[model samples]
Target: MSQQARIDVISGAYGRANRKIEFPKNASGKHESMSDIFGTNVFSIKKMAKSLPKPVFENFRQQLKGGHTLDKVTADAIAHAAKVWALEHNATHFTHWFQPLNDTTAEKHDSFLSLKTTFDNGLAEISALETFSGSELCQSEPDASSFPSGGMRTTFEARGYTVWDTKSPMFIQDGPHGTRVLYVPSVFISYNGEALDEKTVLLRSSSVISKAALDILNLIEPASEDHPRAQNIYTTLGTEQEYFLVDRGLYALRPDLKTTGRTLIGSLPARHQQLEDHYFGKIPTRVLAAMSEVELELAKLGVPIKTRHNEVAPCQFEAAPIFEEAMLAVDHNLITMDVMHRVAHKYKLKCLFHEKPFKGVNGSGKHCNWSLSTDRGENLLSPSSTPETNYRFLLFLVAVLKGVMDHGDLLRTTAASSSNDHRLGAQEAPPAIISVFLGSELTEVLDAIEENRAVDRAVAGTTTTQMRVQGTTLDLKVATLPKLNRDMTDRNRTSPFAFTGNKFEFRAVGSKQSPAFPVTVLNSAVASALLEIKEDLLKQMGDKAVASEEDILAVIRKYITLTKKVRFEGDNYAEEWVKEAEKRGLPNIVKSPEAFKRILAPNNAEMLTRLGVFTQAELESRFHIMNEKYAKEIIIEAQTLWGLLVQHVLPAAFSYRRELSESAAALKQIGAEAAPEMKWLAQLSPLCSDLEDISEELDQLLNEQAPIEDPEKAAEHACYKISPAIEKARELCDKVERLVADKYWPLPKYHEMFSTL
Candidate 1:
């Protein structure tokens, strides 16, 4: 808090202000067209065709297209082809790219060069040769003890394996060290076959849901007009990723962004999104430059990211991709974050994916647009033009509603995290309460079905070709302007689970967390629900002569009546909805830690087990893992806040107080009015004491119960006790920021961060 220290902060601010930015260009002398560079780096089916034999390439493409497995002979052939492709791209090594329990991706590279005993010149010696085999390409062994296992793996049982997931293609990763490695998408698991990674559970759930959906589709004949009865179903996903960009220099100055991925103590800036100017505003030159590089790299990797734009908050932006298979989408999103981080450094910017990097502005969310589709190109969720398809759509819709109503807590739990605690239900994001928003027309149709009454709207209100009457759309209402068309389903930004025109947008998911778990849990719950509905329809048939269509319709009607409570068409953020939700017996999970208990609930566990998504043991391990992660994150934040306040903020506050005191004494000696200095000291003096008191309280909070033996209870204690204390300390420190001289404020203010962009 010395004057010189304050001067250092001022100097840094000026230095940042004078910094000039230059945008880097592609090395090809001219910008490549999207068609020219798209998927160029990927070892795609086309690339496989070029590098592999006719029979081997056809077999590999068949396996990828239809979820079939290749034999060892074919695997060896494919591995040779992949090696040739990677080597052509300057790759010397290959790595199994996997997502661990932590927030990031993990990889361990192994060179293709292998040492072998050879007899050269009649002498036995080890000679190195570039080698690759089916076995080596198929699997990898890595130590799992250091990763978060939550008692799933012990120190003695450190053996784990990563098996190649052929469903997703392998691509070459060009690194900062000028080394290119062939990255094979893989799933990690323990030796005992327990799921140790997010992808394992996701893959299992995909199988379960595909089977469940196929069963339901089989219930109705003439499934697709062009193809036979659907053999397989896939979950389609388009994840919109939001993030913030800070200058690398300023990001280094703030230790919180480095350690926590969020600004722990910055105050709200005066000009942050209040004028509604930044949302969809023109992109900054440097940010656009970085984004262009990110897109180009991702396109080469075949991610197909299609959109990028300024977001609701200053320095915050979003990028989204076209929909892909659920599994591929998850992998693409994980790698997209990595690519963004790396590409951002080229422009001297650090990407912030934290849920709430700055307070008082809108936080980021990974709005997952999800739906179901058949292998024959039939979208199960889309509104059908014919009555037959429309009826099938209603059946699936009712089934999903039942699923969300029954397992709302579990679905909500998937998006829970310590960082998300700062975003949920804050007027910018969806409420913690899970509810379905089916536009006005669809709501009416469902009500009519439940009540056996005639609907005011058409039966298929969501279809583009409305069979009965006119539908709503956007109208500019100007003589010279063109009429803007609208989607069949209206968008409800306030709802956590909204039924968009073609897919459901889960808007509650945090920006930083991977989408694998969220997609897995949701699909699992829906599969369970669909299975239950199928059984109910079969049960209604009994030994009677009732038509199968009648039985299906009866089940749909019953479901509409059962899940009516979860269907809300009004404002979910209002207080009245909260009261109404409680009255209707809906679970409102406000805290992130509270979600773990839901995962432990008997019904939730039983449902997941029955659907083959997770065993009870796996579920318990995951629960423990989440609890430990939440508790540990809070503890670190608390510790970091203590150090930042004690070392920087309080010292700066006290130094300003000292200067005021000295000036007040000088005025008294000169017989001048010392009243202003005395008043300033009075205001600034107590802040020093209050900050010290809060810092002591925070330290005691950490020391008294640093690691509670029970992971669940420790998470609860942190949620109820430790986190609040940290916030209280931050509150005092923020107050000191306002009272201290602007020149002496040590930490970067929000204004400075938003100044450039």
Candidate 2:
């Protein structure tokens, strides 16, 4: 019956809608313009300007721009306008959408309808009316203990608040049966005002980094009205999301995939990504249809999904969006994941966001293209055409290098998870070691800066020369094709953190995890470094209003020397790089537990606390939560693998062996063709025994208790003991799978799952 499920999926015998999804439509049935459909469901600044009084609207705008606290009067006016806008957009209920520490979004919906008591003459009367107030919009109470607080909150003290983030806009989400709810982006905090969610820390990090950066900028160039220091600096991000599409029916058949989001035990297919033909290949028809609907849904909520294409692995694809502010970009990515999962159902597909869904192929990652920018429209990381302007870029660049060097272990912890463990250090993804790749040309430029020599301007040009003959200057490229303008630097996919063009691409982040933590760490680390640079520059100036060119150059040169060891231009996957990194005193932490231990290290904790990104208690809570989460995931995967081996795989093996033995016995009695059956049984019986032995071993490992209170110890045990046992059992299971009859195999094979769609 399980085999039949795989067959049914291959034969396209599942339920899925066949109708076309017409998005961006008007009442007259004509397709609406992108500008018209964009942000129609969102209570945006434009809507606020139209709904609120002129004075109130200006006050709200100033609060957002200036980062000032909103007064009660202003909050009431803004809340009234937002409520009216949400209702006009067909929203009947509202939800405080927040990101919890478990790498998922959470929400609780409340209706706008309310009953008001009034006296009519001598009798009491009840009237129904819609009401929304500033107090309700600004804060909401949720059970703090219900979420993963890492012992920050106990069950007895179950009180948490969701406060409105004024910067991120509120949008309406459509549900089944014409239900629509207003979603206000919020930050979750405990009763004592400790950050209980990802967004709160991210918000604090943003402010810290911006202030630190602005201080340096003010020292270099006095703030004019056009480029004022009061104007907030922002961290911009472009998240490239990668995912896989599997048939929904086939997904339901695999217990491992359903329980652990990966195939724990499956035989590698003969034709899986070996030819390298799947990358950027033609998109499957059904998958394209699903992506179209997903884009349309995102468009209504103001998500700028700009690109889609096939990724490196078969059945894997990528969806990338245009750059936006850090907070909004994280919010939109969460929305994108939700939309992809919800939309895939209509096409009988399941979107897999696991880091490594398949064992032997490439895994998925969220390539975060991160950079710093100012409200004055200047990209801090971008190099200018002239040598003078490039000095400012070099200062910012050196700050990032120093930041990454000092906090390499802490940065690795941001991407730490059991699922991500399988993906990292693989050929297709960056390794566990944290290193920066600035390409060869940028390395040379930095070298020149450190040596106090002139930088070659042509090396920093945006275009590369066309291909030519080996010994001649004549170009042999196609005459009809135009000259291509490439990026200023070559891309390095093997590095965990690489400078692509103007921004750094944090390629080690797991697809299934939230970008908030990684971004927060990155912001805090760079801010700490920037603050140091500002102090150094101030000390060198010694009461001078402006430092001389020599002083500025000396400061930049000092940083280049301090951070020189972290910049690697070689292959991160190469084994030599690991040994070399150790020689350079760089950490190469391979396990999540080791990485988590550094979160509360003296330097890391001090930086985070001093920057106001997280209190000491908050940082401690995160450490416990990450360790506990890692251990729990490993145990779950182990349990699921054990269940499959005991109930599903071993039984299949036994049935096949019994059938072979009986057939051999019957053939022997008739004196006909018994040699083949006997040989088959001989090969299958020992493997079946070995499979049972290893499964029992795995079961024992599962039963072995690590101290529950010590999460670090428990995580280490799970990583060292249970994980290896699971791998051993998987090896035995795969060996048996090759011998078992196709009809007897219970779970769907890899070939069927990868090729059917």
On lDDT, the leading prediction is 2
In model 1, which runs have C-alpha deviations exceeding 4 angstroms?
1-31, 58-69, 223-226, 385-389, 458-470, 473-475, 541-548
**Predicted candidate 1 versus true structure: per-residue lDDT over 27-111, tens digit per residue:** 8766667767778788887777877889887787788756568878888988988888888889999999999998789999999
Give the runs in model 2 whose Cα sits over 4 Å from its true position: 13-17, 224-230, 386-389, 456-476
C-alpha lDDT (0 to 100) for residue 259 of candidate 1: 87
lDDT of 1 at 358: 89
What is the TM-score of candidate 2?
0.96
Q: What residue pairs are clashing in model 1?
A: 1-651
lDDT of 2 by residue, 581-660 (tens): 99999998888888999999899999999998999999999999998899999999988998998899989999999999
How does each model score on TM-score? Answer: 0.94, 0.96
